[model samples]
Target chain A: MEQNACCSRREHDLQRRVRAFAEERDWGQFHTPKNLAMALAGEVGELIAEFQWLTPEQSAEVMSDPEAGGRVRAEIGDVMIYLTRLADVLGIDLADAALSKLENSALRYPTDQVRGSAAKR
Target chain B: MEQNACCSRREHDLQRRVRAFAEERDWGQFHTPKNLAMALAGEVGELIAEFQWLTPEQSAEVMSDPEAGGRVRAEIGDVMIYLTRLADVLGIDLADAALSKLENSALRYPTDQVRGSAAKR
Candidate 1:
């Protein structure tokens, strides 16, 4: 794919690409929702590993290190790939799913109630 | 607040509650964007910690265990709380932010290109 082709792409598009990539290889059979969810969790675990035990400043440096940053980015991509695929498999429009959740959140966190709170009631 | 009052609320509402909880306690001063981001990362770290090295089956059990599940939920709540606050501080509508990202993804992941793929490029 052209670099520019992905430059303007959104999360769902990346997800689709990953899914298509898998499908082209006949990997869909392996992508059961449960498995996909596990894959996502694993990728997230990888992401966390990148920063494990790092001080805040070191964590910042990790993001700046080409190798570490690339690894982290790849892991993030992996998580998103599974997430989008799972959403697609479930017939969910990621955008709509996110928006609906946001709407519900708006009602729960009225400005007055959640302007700067950190504690859970 | 009444449990019933919170039962019907959304993610944004929960975020709002957390933010308000902090604000009411004069904690906004501590919620700089960087700090909030760090806090979010910390919460995510905690979430991941709950399942570190567990087998997939074990992870499922963790979620089913009331104690582990509660910790995970609390961590997730912490991440969301920081995320919503960051959105609020940045003047973003979480719903709109998520929707906008989704719209971008839809374009990128046309059905023809992304039916079941997993490879990048």
Candidate 2:
């Protein structure tokens, strides 16, 4: 019940969709965590490639450009799908993992100390 | 309203949390999409590093080992957080972006064509 507080219904649905999509194609054997992680890394690279040469202003407004926006959205989708699949395969709760990580970050970089600054704590 | 069907409540909450966290620290100026995308790339590298030397089987079972699992979970957290933040900054709906991407992939790599194999389409 406590876990449900953080985990979203659609997140689980997306995970199930990913699982079923792979299952229907008998792709489980190929979806080892290592493989998924590597796939994830490749997707991240592709995602970053979309913003490779853009200025900060351009990067911020990328989604407004039809071609680049489509590419970026597709990459985001690829990244999330792989990430969701990887976490599902590993029995990891993404919401819990992310929230706890944020908590740790908050502690590490207290607002009062880190305000207006980007520095390691 | 239609978007609500795919978007989960907690996903938005997490995005809000990410936004607020940065806002409190005045980190928005530094969170250009390019920077966030690169930061995401770095986090993916860290996630990949967690399984760098592990065999497929080892990678699958890595989460059962507390020490490695903790590190892996933390990396996942970092990756997801950066990803969520990046998507948020771009005004892209993560669920919509990812779901549509999956739909596109289904068309590109039909189950019958790519079943039980890892091949590009």
Candidate 3:
């Protein structure tokens, strides 16, 4: 499959914005891996909060409400932001890591063995 | 800032892997925006589970432990996987969306105003 040149460009683009955002405030000094990881968790919390009380079906439908959809998207964006920042601080290539994981998933849960079964194991 | 060619490549690479995997099981039909969004939320829930009981400081330190770190990494990967899948279904360009968001963030949270304060407000 051909790789999307644009995706790599975007990751690099997000990296710069993240780096510059931190640098402008001299916040680089605070972006320790531990701190960034915590931030990642926190942002994920906010993302989940948007669906805190919804039933499974409702959770699926959470976005049918414009206000809720907007919040979810913002939280999604926040998750992306912190994930990008964490990777930038750790020098991990998110795109590389993501691809590698998917490749591994392909291996771990072979189609013939895992198809029709949603369970991870 | 120069976009990283490699990052985009990885995203495309992941997309192919995702498409191939779903197609193998004929799961494409289930990839509705609502279902994908719900999956995204579920994955984020699992990610948060890794740090649920930890105090703020302990949450930051969660990854210092090898076992905990591995779990966190797995959950993080899961989150990324679902995110990529969701974006793919929605026809959203994660990289482009990410950049546009960062640009917006730069405007909303100006350095001088937000630097000293960690609050999102």
Candidate 4:
């Protein structure tokens, strides 16, 4: 699939804004791609913590509770921010990478072959 | 800043595509929000593993190596797919959530107050 021009522009705008935000506070010095990737892991850890110990049904309905929902949303945002920064620092186009990976996944796990099974083929 | 219309549409479209991908393989049963969040953590772990024990400079330049770069990109894609799926399961607007968090971060870490420092305010 072709990358949408508008999406590309918006992603660039978002990256610029994030870069500016860090630059404004001289945080760029601290934002090595390694640090950002680790930070991304930390944020994902927090996201996972939100769902920890919840029953599957409860987790699926987590957003129904305002407080838990807010925490989850905030963690999600943190994860995205760090991930975006890491991609930018590494000169990777995140959206393209994701789309390409999805395409590869589709090929690797064809529907008919993988249906109802979690085993790696 | 208001969420761009095109960005919102793109995010939703991506979410739908992810959802359909899982549904097609009868994988929805394994995709509870908790499972997705944990899977997200696992992917982030893989991303961090790529940079582990490298000097900061080497970690920063990880993508200079084609093989390492591909692994990093694939890990990033996995993280995003699981994150996108988690948000979808919980009915979260991920872009809105990230923008909101960024706005909050701006307020929490004012440029003038936080400049040249890594301290969280």
* B39-110 per-residue lDDT for model 3 (tens digits): 776776676676567665675566678887766666667767777776666455666666666777888888
Residue B52, candidate 3: how far off, in angstroms?
9.0
- Candidate number that wins on TM-score, 2 or 4: 2
TM-score of chain A of 4: 0.90
For each candidate in turn, the TM-score is 0.49, 0.95, 0.71, 0.91
What Cα-based lDDT does every candidate model obtain? 0.53, 0.89, 0.68, 0.83
lDDT of 1 by residue, A51-106 (tens): 56666556545545778655544544444455556555544444434344445556
DockQ of each: 0.07, 0.83, 0.29, 0.70
Clash number by candidate, in order: 31, 0, 3, 0
Check candidate 3 and list the clashing pairs: A7-B8, A8-B7, A8-B8
The reply for model 3, stretches above 4 Å from the true place, is A1-7, A51-67, B1-10, B28-75
Output the worst ten-in-a-row residue range by lDDT, candidate 2 chain B.
Answer: B1-10
Worst 10 residues of 4 chain B by lDDT: B1-10
Question: Candidate 2, after superposition: displacement of residue B53 in Å?
Answer: 0.4
What does the lDDT read for residue B104 in candidate 2? 85
TM-score (C-alpha, index-matched) for candidate 1: 0.49
Q: Which segments of model 1 are wrong by more than 4 Å?
A: A1-12, B1-121
Superposed by TM-score, candidate 4 places the C-alpha of residue A19 at a distance from the truth, in angstroms, of 1.2
The fraction of correct interface contacts reproduced by each prediction comes to 0.04, 0.81, 0.28, 0.70
How far residue A8's Cα lies from its native spot in candidate 2, in Å, is: 2.5
lDDT of 4 by residue, A18-96 (tens): 8888999999889987888878987887888899989999998888899998898899988888887888898877766
Interface RMSD of each: 8.8, 0.9, 4.0, 1.4
Candidate 2's C-alpha lDDT? 0.89
